[model samples]
Target: MQKLIFSFLMALASLSAPLQASEPASTHANITQEVNDWLNTSLSNSPGAFSFELRPIVSRLKLDGCTQREISLPQGNRLVGNTMLRVKCIEGANWMFNLPVKISIQVQYAVAARPLAANQEISTGDIAMQQGDLATLPGSVILDPATAIGRALNSPVAAGQTLRQEQLRTAMAISQNQKVKIIFRQDGIEISNEGIAMNAAAEGQPVRVRLDKGKTITGTAQLGGIVDVGP
Candidate 1:
């Protein structure tokens, strides 16, 4: 999962030169420190707070420790709950083994404060903040309430349901037949005019409008029903 991949990348920074095969392999205490160090370093950028526990290696298993080796995790899976890391020796004895790690990440995500109907515009009161583990929730859960505000839902959301980006629709900044302010700038000269939108458009999307003079122009849509044209 993401946590393991991140730790593996940071592991590159702490890698040391291979020691002689006769040299004693890394101890459990050493691994605990190294693993925890990288795990803390890389996960600091995560959107939520996290805690992890490194499972103890069996004393009976005489597998070579990673003094100079690569640690990787299975792909196409999120890094949470119970997971195993593959540690392969690149120097000394040719050996490989698996180490178990458990991760828990708690994030503050947005959820519906009340039952919301489809296409209903979202307001501050419509969403409430909830704290829970990321693994138990939808991957695309919205973490910011500002992201949901002013947007309409694609389907009805039950109260207490976690909000996701895919379930919401972005509010259009332009609408057909609506009067939109148009701005034009060329050769350092700027002018403003008004026009009727020929088609609906979202912010930053192209829009066509008919001016007072019966001339049509294409421009980039802006918020507040404004459009920018001419360079």
Candidate 2:
């Protein structure tokens, strides 16, 4: 009696071993085949030229970190992998489709913040306008060149248009300088300061001088060289 009972128990144990071991592999194989079939069907039925690619499906399986592979559907098309297949059509297709998309994504968790939330975009720049006094702040997004110039006096600045600091400073300085007439007399020849000097003078160089409305008179003078005229 004891020997017969032992033999029966051993046979039961042997039967249970194969069933347990085969469960997971059978499940995985079934899932893989189903997904492949669904994708193949969708690709064939797609209207016009269509493309698709497999994306890694990331989700928790039971208590373990499971990698569920999926495809990143082109355009707004809907596609999902579950026991029951999910599919839907989209307005237009933009990206191409690739196959199998070997599932390699690890399950991730959401903590303090949802790290997987849609990406946040950064703004480049904006335009604004000012309406009040020159001292008051402008209330518009589009910025004017004049206002920008005032703010950029001492700092490095880049704007919608490229203006060289050296060139701009030179032009502004020339605009601010007082108009003066330069005149020179060499023997019988008489020449005005404007005729003699194409560029503004150095601090100590002597340039022929005359007032804009005055006579042609030769004087030792400097160009941009500041001179205290009149007592």
Candidate 3:
């Protein structure tokens, strides 16, 4: 009877030994498995369409200020045949805790972004324009910032570019004093007159020329205010 009781006790201990030995490792494995599942699901099932860019396997991970743990196979666990997928879990916190967590991962992806072109004419909205009566100003177009009005959107206008109203505006024409010669012809005599410029002119413009001798002549010429005439 004594020998039989001792044998039964030994058998119980033998069974208990394996469980004790595996308890810690099994707990860790559970945690690892759980986390792995979370990641896999996010990669496959999420409606946001996530992609798994597998990075180099990190050897260890820490959770919530805890010591980092390594993932490995169970000691007595063995596979019958060779398999491509090797799933391992870490031993942690008493229970077989396997849970996956999302981590910030860096990946390379292609995206479309706007780029400024060379020689593109910039629009008025692109620049700041002052609000005031432009006619009252010396020039037709008065820029609010002054510097922003006329600027190149891109370097030079490309060959196939269509000019847009936003990209361009009528430049303010300025007036300046100029000297012009006034000629008077009476019968067979010709008289020449010279005077200071009164105002600025535009290209292909016509202006009235006033002579010093109280005479005025109306003529059309390329307007630049400054004109050349013979002696």
Best by TM-score: 1
List model 3 lDDT by residue over 69-100, tens digit each: 44333444221111112233333342122222
Candidate-wise lDDT, in order:
0.82, 0.34, 0.40
lDDT of 3: 0.40
- Candidate 2 lDDT, 1-231, residue by residue in tens: 999999999999999988666423213343446566666765564322333344432332221212343433455433322112332212222222233342111211111111111112111221222232211212232223343232112223333322223312211111123465444455666554442322343344343444456543334444353322221
After superposing candidate 3 on the true structure, give the runs of residues whose Cα lies further than 4 Å from its correct spot. 1-5, 11-24, 27-33, 41-48, 53-231
Top-down lDDT ranking: 1, 3, 2
Candidate 2 yields a Cα-based lDDT of: 0.34
Q: Tens digits of per-residue lDDT for model 1 on 133-183?
A: 887888799998998899888899999999999999876789899999999
Off by over 4 Å in 2: 17-22, 25-30, 59-231
By lDDT, the best candidate is 1
Candidate 3, residue 134: Cα displacement in angstroms equals 48
Worst 10 residues of 2 by lDDT: 109-118
Query: Each candidate's TM vs. the true structure?
Result: 0.73, 0.24, 0.22
* TM-score of candidate 1 to 2 decimals: 0.73
